[model samples]
Target: MSNIVSVFAQKCADYDEKNVQSAIDSLFAQMGGVAAVVPQNAKVFVKVNLVREMSPEKCGTTHPEVAVAVCKRLLTVTPNVTVGDSCAGMYNKGMLASVYAKCGMTAIEDRTAARLNQNFETGVADVNGKVLGKCEFTSAFLDADVVVNVTKLKTHSFTGYSGAVKNLFGLIPGMVKVEMHSRFPDLTAFCDLLCDVCEFARPKTVLNVIDAVWGMEGDGPTNGKPKFIGHLLASADPYALDAVAVSLFGDPRSMPVLQAAMKRGLLQDDLANIRFDFERWKAKRIDNFDAPPIDHTDFFGNQLAWINRLAKKHMVKRVHPDKTCRGCGKCAMHCPAKAITLVKRKAKVDQRKCIHCYCCQELCPFDAVRFRTSLLYKLARRFSGKRSKNT
Candidate 1:
């Protein structure tokens, strides 16, 4: 615990294959070489944020070039490297085939020696988590000797920021994620659970690499605008990686997931104790970066009849599908609250039953679903802004 946390970061302007590979090799060499983490003959699982079946251009998942770069480096260590992720979709052969093909992961297998893991079996592991005792994890994730967690930097509607820790949530398959969300709906609880899962998976994760070459803002992990971050980050500690990645956007303290981890004494309060080797990368940092906007409707402290009614009418943020919806029923299928119904072709969310989890926005392949804030909510944010400044 006394040892300093090491986080390495460098700007990667684009997903140029040779450029990314060289950067990885250079970062590893600077950090005491690749042997510092992966050993020869190790069975390495290159875990990418294949959160959904999307092209790398969407900036939704890890770039194929980045995955291939890590796989190639692992190849220098061992031949048993496999790349995989269990995103928010059916984990069948047909689905996995399409996801891999669409996400440019097939290119990783084609161009490199790494195999595409299509394993759909599930297994339970004891995380010794603070929130829950154990969790259901994909066997491919649990069985691997080493898991190189390759993640994308993005903003999540649920978690304040989607970085290294939130990326590990993909380790749990699509459906289990829905169940877990149902169990822990509060932001602090959900974030605590996220920390539990990350801590559980940390032992097997030899390295955590974030693909910030191009990142996402606004509503993300599924729908958002792609912004060029021009950076690649690597670290032995996932917590440290997240700490550094979120800093580039703004104050990490404003982020709830990061705060939850720190509150649990899982991470350092500040990065002063951590060591970085980026060498003036801050000169390229985005000063006007657009972080995902937050709605503080988490205050349901009273259940009075009139109070509940008022909250029902004004406090809740509504999800509405616009004209862009292709009516694929992904929202209806994945809705944990069973609040969504496909009327004709468009997905209709029953406001009475909706939990405002924002799962629809997170998983919708098309950028169809978005938030509709109420009048009173806007007024509340205005007053809260001044209150925050005064405090």
Candidate 2:
């Protein structure tokens, strides 16, 4: 298999139909064209990163312009292209419509011949991986003859980085994802399960594309600053794609999912094997890219059990639902551990039952979720003024 990851210079605001489509056309051409991955008259499912009901400009979800551009390209090879994703919450048609409308996915149907995935049906897949044996997935993804993962690049509060591999977590469908978090509270194990899901879906996945034209930098998947990266990336291998994607901001090994993937022999820490314009892309790297404190969370994977406990106790950010919480009950409904409760029309977290999974923080629509570091962690960061260099 070829280890090349294609990179293209583009922007979110480059909404000119010809410019966007040409970039995508060139991107697919770099990897032997859409016809190479997509077969004639085959069913194609374009899985986008619709994390929640966020607009395209937020950089939280996949931009519809990119999705439309990609779907238009895929439609040349197959007329049966559908676009959709299972956001965090209830998995129903009503929820789907709301998310689709808010996230601007409705544009795909208007702009291209592709149809939006109306299939809310969920089914269990026999994913017999080390961490995940069986799990629920959206049937739209499973029933497709070919799957194209179009993901948004973001920094995750819990997982450190969200790229091609982390985007597949959306396939699990709604609140079931919250349950998985409670089941595997440890960062390493959760990331292992992520690897398991990716491996299970890897066979049908033909191409992985990252929307780095604009990406979130701090406290993301949902809430963060949208920075202009002005680039897009594609690869047949998700691992290699992520390895290159993460390198744009930080070390790939620092990402929990990538670390777990390497341990499972799915990827390597070194990027020497991946074929890309290294020096050219390296020049585009953002030196001040705001990223999560991954080093603090790496303690969860330490061999010493006490160190793990210590990290869990103090190193991790504590979830605090502030006064801004609008009593929407979304966090309570989606809390995997059932640790969040609404009292007096306000959300309250039972810390004793809290798994530190940060689901409440991630899915809160009101942006009311606040994370407070412990005194010990603060002191440590104070002493260590700057994070160690990635090299």
Candidate 3:
């Protein structure tokens, strides 16, 4: 395979409304220029990561300035550019329209007259004979001559981190994401499935732009601490883009998603092959940021045969919301196990049926689901921690 991954980074000290546009424009120019990838007059679909309904200050979704800059650039090539993402559980186009309005992209629809194609359909993706059934997708995605994947860099509770690859997962539509999660319950398996989804939609994603100007750390994608990285990254390879993102945090190899991607041969693990324009950008470490701990042996340990016999398999439980949830039904809609139900406008979990796949927590629009560890599990972890220190 050709060494197809190219990354260009640009440092912009401010994310304020005044400088955001110029920064994006400069980013576009430095990253091989968008014109080279997107042809003039081609039907281009720009997929922005709008995972949840939160203001730009919350850093829960892609910055509208980033999207506006992309649209502005692409419009130079084609007026056929369309921008949209299937929001989690809610399909209120007006809410998304409002986000665009706040970010100065209202002109995409109103002024520049860019097409807003929102109707998506269910499709199937086959991964190494394992078929992911009933995936909801926008027809514009499949029909587009080129796709620009714009994503935010953030840490995730389940998949380790969310970047260019995880952003596309939103395209699968609301509840269908839950079903996929149920099918591939393990993190490694789920990431493999994500790669398959990318392969199937490879033709669509011709370019990737990651908004790292401001990102989330420590249990994010949403509901995490925001860190200002003051950088913009662009690449043609999603894997390469994600690989670079993991390095920015500290240890890329330690990340489960990157480790899984490396094992599957989906990306180059060698950082040597990957080039970085450090002159334009610099790495900033996140202080006091601890990646959520996982039971390596339980999740990836080979002693499963022994543990299964000794400890009863803990059935997955729906993380209880410490506070009253907004009753958005996003969890119910995206529960892959279908274990969550709405009771009097509140979400109720049937622990017996929950597989602990964590789709509910990841897809919760309200960030209400907090992982609850039982007393016994806590004791076990305590013992495990002591044993590791002694060794």
Model 3 has an lDDT value of 0.67
lDDT tens per residue, model 2, 167-242: 8888998888988988898887888988999998899888888988889988887878898887778887888889
- Candidate 1 residues lying further than 4 Å off, grouped into runs, are 1-3, 277-282, 295-316, 386-391
Between candidates 1 and 3, name the one with more favorable lDDT: 1
- Candidate 3: stretches off by over 4 Å: 1-4, 90-107, 110-113, 121-136, 277-283, 294-300, 303-305, 308-312, 315-318, 326-330, 342-345, 362-366, 374-391
TM-scores of all candidate predictions against the true structure: 0.92, 0.94, 0.84
Clashes of each: 0, 0, 1
Question: Which regions of candidate 2 deviate over 4 angstroms?
Answer: 1-13, 295-304, 380-391
In order of TM-score, best first, we have 2, 1, 3
CA lDDT for candidate 1: 0.80
Query: Comparing candidate 2 with candidate 3, which one achieves the higher TM-score?
Result: 2
Question: What's model 2's lDDT at 149?
Answer: 96
Which candidate model has the greater lDDT, 2 or 3? 2
Show the lowest summed lDDT stretch of 10 residues, model 1. Answer: 382-391
- Give per-residue CA lDDT, model 1, range 276-338, as digits (tens): 743464666577676655533443435545644564467656899998888999989988888
Error of 2 at 110 (Å): 0.7
On a 0 to 100 scale, what is the lDDT of residue 322 in model 1? 90
